[model samples]
Target: MGDENVDEIIKDFILLQDDIVIDRYSNGGANGELYFGERKLLSDRVALKFYYYNKDVSTHNEPLILKSIEHPNILKIYDAKIIHQQYAYFLTPEISGGDLKNFKDNNIVSFYDAINITQGILNGLSELHKNPNNLLHRDLKPKNILIDQETKTPYIADFGSVKFISNAENSVVASKSTQIYRPNESVVQNVYNRQSDIYQVGIIFFQLLGGKFPEAPFEWLDDRQKSKFLKISGSEFEKWQFIDSAIDNLIVKNKLLDYDSLPAYINNKVKAVIKTATNKDLNKRYFTCSEFIKDLFDLKKQNKDWRIDNQEIYANKENKKYYRISEDKKGYCLQVSKNQVNWTKDNKHDGTLESIISRIHKD
Candidate 1:
């Protein structure tokens, strides 16, 4: 049947179900479409994704994979159904805040907000990486990350390219993965592992920190462009030399001011983290999301006297004392006063503010 006819049938079929299709959300994979919907019984808003059964095994397994995991930062699957063994539908909460790409395009994300969003994504990845079901989100890009309008929290979505690490032997190379965010090892060796996901996260972090992606010469070009360039050049070694030169330029160039022009201390730390995460060697990159989170928190704690201008102040509701933590020329210090604390403690540099707060709360 034609796609138009199939879509019409699916639309009519969905109406018969409990959901009222509000509007078309997006064109999903070649054989699928996403719709903004509302449940008739409860009037609850939802995102309905419909896929033809003949699409691919991954499309059919997407719902099951999502249903297996339950994390706030991960996309929640509300319902699923197979219509007459032809079309499969899966329902999830409608994220009006849209994807990360939209969010980044519309607003100037603060340093703290970037860290928070990246941390949330890392937390979701941690859950996916742990225990019985070791899964790799082979495709982790800004478009696949949805944000909640109210909470401003980011949620990982679109599991169509998810892979089970345990079944690596049986898995085929993901030729369709987004090359911009793909890891070097994966691109060169056709291997997608946990480290590959980490590499994508690193790219996301770089994007969040710097407005533009890291330009590695031919790496930024699409496959077709790269192919044509290589065909004209006739030497793969020339491409490697060009890529190496780009990397060297990035190393020497002072481009940190392009993003938010963050403080030198904060900017250096962020760069260091990105460098480690995006390292070409899988062994050198962050082994787990938890490790990456630790580095981010440590960076947050490392800078002394790093002024967060116009940022929200944290206060203890019970004590009514405003708390501010910052690093200075001396060391890390916590300031507590009626509204803002100016007094600096010179000898309190044991750990990060997060650790200190956790210790104090425990005590």
Candidate 2:
């Protein structure tokens, strides 16, 4: 569908509603569009999400799912309506802080912030996994977690791919989660359950700590292979195709996630928690959201004021030197310190995290 065609659908929706007025377009994805809208009756601005009916995307269950799980850490659904089965539109109070991906990319996520955010997400997941609900958030990624600009609270958003565990015996659906975030079992055996949800949460937890998405079950690939993937010369679509093929090859080999990429500043306890949560072996993974939440709390008690006050520190094991990257009005600033304390800025290495890390060994 073209942009004009989608716009016309939005126009049709506006015509049907008397009080709902879409102010402007916010963003969009493969499934639908998000707009900043207002409820005239309530005098409140809302996030209006409109999903065009498509067989490929399962968004029809989102409204009921949101209504079922009413949580402070979960996105609240105000109202919803289906217009002639062509489009499904819903309203949620606008989250000003945007999604976690943008929040992570733009600012430094401190250990404190990381723990708090992850816990908030787990709290929301607890509601879904507990009795009466017995639901699974089939998709849990950075993009699906929304941040509140004012309180810095994280709210679990997006429920289009949710599934009820109770119905497992009667219904079986193919997993549609993004490939990188999928657990090994989900990718290999088509299993989507509580553990699968935990695995995806583990990936997001790692990203929250290191600011990089882990390529689980393929993270062990040698530097040469990784370098080729990074240096691939092609259009965005072609690069993605190459990535897909690489992931497929890794799946065929039955590889597992590795923790080599995590920064040294992260304590062993934290890493152990992450490893257990994302363990390729379902038996080793946390059995429930409550277990994950308890371990996180224990870590907090053990390391109240995580020794390093600086949030941007990243270590390169090859050089045995610690580096910190900070963002300023000009660009990213890279600094190096043999010990974690004293520092010297490396003027020539100000760029993206990948670029800075790539040059860390050379220095």
Candidate 3:
């Protein structure tokens, strides 16, 4: 409600070449009256999200951190401004496709569709994980993922609770935006780490596949682990470091339930990837987003239809990347590209199986 803050947002908006039109929408968000704006400072079509200035301003750093990250799957941040000292962000892409949460309640999303969504999120996180600056998305959920109707592309949005690898940079006494997303129920203390973000990804995958939090399914957990999972659903929110890890490890206890009850779309390969990432023990799980992406590619091949003799158009001369065309081979596959790129190429001479995995173990 301050004049200075109002001018800051107006100026930021006007500076935008797209020049967003400001208007508040009564629907959408459950928080204070949802607002809608076109031609946001963030992008040509994306809208601006503004929450009335409450006491917590830790979220004020969200736009700052988002602007620093760039990836095809991640939502693009255009600008950050204040409306009455309240933070507002502008994004580049229009999210008319709707969210995964919306699709679940209305109807069942095909298994293939679910895989694609999981793949996209994994790709985005893969890029973010490599960032040397140490970015951990503390709050990753269905509501924060914006979907595009035409491409069915999902962009990760909402950085209000993002944790920097190192910094008290965004925190202050007056109004930190920490409580909205940061939970106080965990035994481990909070610190940004790749395992932490991976856990959130598992939560996203679980929600999409199950259509809601599996609180009742996991109600058997002790009060501490149950409380942590119910809050943010991971040890990333742990109140203390050493103690939290032990508790999380004990909680996973490999009680993966009702895999058979899952829809046919819930293929075995995809299930393993999701299960490993979400496992309570960080040690046995994918350590980085990059690892998660790699495993996703491997899992994707399981359901793909590819032929060694006559593969489909897997490349364009202009694009450096290529794929092994598949419809459904009904089994496992190993796709080796023709071009210069290769991690396995170097590790395993030329295209020989010697460099790759050795023969199966007799045991």
Best by TM-score: 2
Off by over 4 Å in 2: 1-5, 15-21, 53-59, 167-174, 214-242, 248-258, 304-363
Number of the top lDDT candidate: 2
The lDDT for every candidate, in the order shown, is 0.67, 0.73, 0.52
Candidate 3 residue spans exceeding 4 A from truth = 1-33, 37-44, 52-58, 85-92, 106-108, 167-192, 210-260, 264-267, 304-363
Sum up the clashes in candidate 3.
22
| lDDT of model 3 at position 226 | 60
TM-score-best of 2 and 3: 2
How do all the candidates rank in terms of TM-score, highest first?
2, 1, 3
In model 2, which residue pairs have backbone atoms overlapping below 3 Å?
none
True-structure lDDT of candidate 3? 0.52
lDDT of model 3 at residue 172? 16
Across 1-363, the per-residue lDDT of candidate 2 in tens digits comes to: 233556676766665767867667755543678777678889887887888765556657887788877898999998887764578787889887789888877766766677788899999998888888888888899889999876779998888788787844522354766887777777667777787788778878888887345545345345776787678788888766766666755543434344666664566788889988887788889988889989988876554222123655454433356667767777677887778689898876547655665565345
Query: TM-score per candidate, in order?
Result: 0.68, 0.73, 0.57
Better of 2 and 3 by lDDT: 2
**Residue 281's C-alpha lDDT in candidate 2?**
80
Candidate 1 vs candidate 2: the lDDT winner is: 2
